[model samples]
Target: MRILIVHNLLWAHYKASVFQALQHLVDQQPDLSIRVLQIARNERSRASLETATDADTPTYTYQYELLFDRFLEDISLTERAQALLRHARAYKPDVINLTGYYDPAQLLLLAWAKLNGIRVVMQNESTAADHQRSGWKELFKRSVFRACDGFFCFGSQSADYLIQLGVPPAKILLRKNAVDNEALRAVYEQTLPNRTRLQQSLHLQTNNFVFVGRLIEVKNLPMLLNAFAEALKRSVNALNWGLILLGDGDQWAELSQQIGSLKLTDRVTLLPGRPWFRVPEVLALSNVLVLPSRSEPWGLVVNEAMVCGLPVIVSERCGCVQDLVHPDETGFVFDPEEPDKLTQLMVKFMDDLVDTQRMAYYAQQYIAPYAPDVVAQEMLDGFREITN
Candidate 1:
């Protein structure tokens, strides 16, 4: 069986890892083979991440074609649609998997696939609570969902959204979104010995809560700052705990100013964004991972942290919270809207109320099912199920 996947970003290392794993499966299985059509090298905003990671050598192994080899924003919609349709026709896949529900370019390909009797599988990331759902958009999404033969969702939240839209539960294939666990864990373990030197050289505290991603407004950085500040005030071990924001965005200046205004200049560290492959190195410098996004699709950083054996303090709104968080076992979850709730969770770690070592163990064990080889096999099985 030939499976064609249409994905937008070439810079997405997490997706690349899964594709690499799937390709490995194809080599062994022989009957199942796949092709990925990557639309662009990177998004304009994430261009910084494309630089100098082991210089010129790719991090993960995968087979894919770069449709544009440029940033997604630089390509015109007409060009995108034409290129996608052209490739879909040439591949003549038995089944085609779309990256998301939106993108008229891919939507047109979806329509073409259904008309030609090629099975369609949707790869979804959006969840019900992450965005404002207007009636017209939801109606459009329903129409899109109706065309697909199967679904591969990011988590329970995304699969639930499809079920709500009238899709049969049997058609939902997978609920796992993954990163290169082996790679991240390797980096984390290798850097563990040098962690003390790294932290001292960077002037970071002995224990810190690390946030890794773009510093945009939707991430709710200001609220995280306020919550962290409040936690500091309430904890006796405040002097030993700190917060690190590791990414850059429009909110960079605003967040920097807020850090000072909150009198958290000494306790908070704002580092520029690094490549996703290097994230576990930063993970080595910190004690826990925190993602307080007001609206997040799946928050893959939570997976990265778990792979590195760090307990996470994720917001309840993140799609990952449903699968990756287990409140006191794997980690804790709280509402992003309430500063006190986040503050209290932070205090648990600071006051040694939560057993970090035990929770870290649970996090690693809990995330095992989301590993690359395991997730790839599930995806391959879904393809076999739908095409049969």
Candidate 2:
């Protein structure tokens, strides 16, 4: 059976890792063959995250075709659609996995596949809580969803959203997502010995809570800063802890102003974005990873943090909270709207009220099942189940 998977970005190291593993698995299974069509080289917003990955050193290697070797936004809808259709028609896949319903180009491909009697799978990541859903948009999504034969969701939250839209539970083929856990952990382990020196050289505190990603408004950085300031005020051992915002965004000036207003200029440090592979270096300097986004589809950074053996503090609205955070175990989850709730958890970390080491151990254990190779196996199985 031939499977053609349409992915939106070639910049996704994590997704590329999973595809690499899938390549190995498909090689072993003589009955299975697959090709991934990367829609674009990278999205403009994420280009900075891959700056350090040398072109010659392709750690993000997989058997894939690039439909557009440029930013997704720079490619017109007509160009994208024509390229996708041209390649897809030539490949003649028995089954096609679409990126998502939001992309008009992919939606057009879905329509073509339906007309051609090709099996189609919807790969979804959006959760119901990601944003306020309008009725018309939901209705439109339902229409597109009705055309797909199967679904592969990022997690239970995504699967639940599909069910809410009238999809049967049985149609949900795979409900998992993963990152390159082994590679991320390897970098963290290699940087472990110099963590203290690195922190000291950087003038960072002994313990730090890091927020890594774009400084976009949805990340709720102002609220995170407020909560961190409050936590520092309330914790007696606060002097030993600090906060790091390791990303650049449009909100840089605004966040910087807020940091000054909250009198946390010294307690909080703003760092620029780095290549995803180098994220473990920041993880090494941090005691915990904090994702205070008001709405997150699935916080993959939590997976990265857990893989690096650091506990996470995520907002309840994050889809990954349900699967990754285990209150007082792997980490804690709080309502983003409740600044006091977030502050209390931050205090617990600083006051020695939480067992950091134990939580770190459990975090790694909890993420083990979501490793790339494991998820690849599940994806391969899902493809076989659908095609046969």
- In the range 59-82, model 1's lDDT, one tens digit per residue, is 666678999989999999899999
Query: Candidate 2: TM-score?
Result: 0.97
- Tell me the spans in candidate 1 whose CA falls farther than 4 Å from its real position: 53-58
TM-score of 1: 0.97
The candidate maximizing lDDT is 1
Model 2 C-alpha lDDT per residue in residues 1-388, reported as the tens digit of each score:
9999999998887898899999998888787788999999999987766675465333855679988889999999999899999999999999998989989999999999999989999999999999888789999999998999999898999999999999989889987889989878888998989989999888899999999999999999999999999898899998999999999899999999999999988889999988787888899999999999999889999999999989889998998987889998999999899999999989998999999899989998999999889988888777777777
In model 2, state the lDDT of residue 42: 93
Number of residue pairs clashing in candidate 2, backbone atoms closer than 3 angstroms, sequence gap of 3 or more or interchain: 0
Which pairs of residues clash in candidate 2, taking residues 3 or more apart in a chain or in different chains? none
Minimal lDDT window, size 10, model 1: 52-61
**What 10-residue stretch in candidate 2 is worst by lDDT?**
52-61
Q: Which stretches of candidate 2 lie over 4 Å from their true place?
A: 55-58
lDDT of 2 at 368: 96
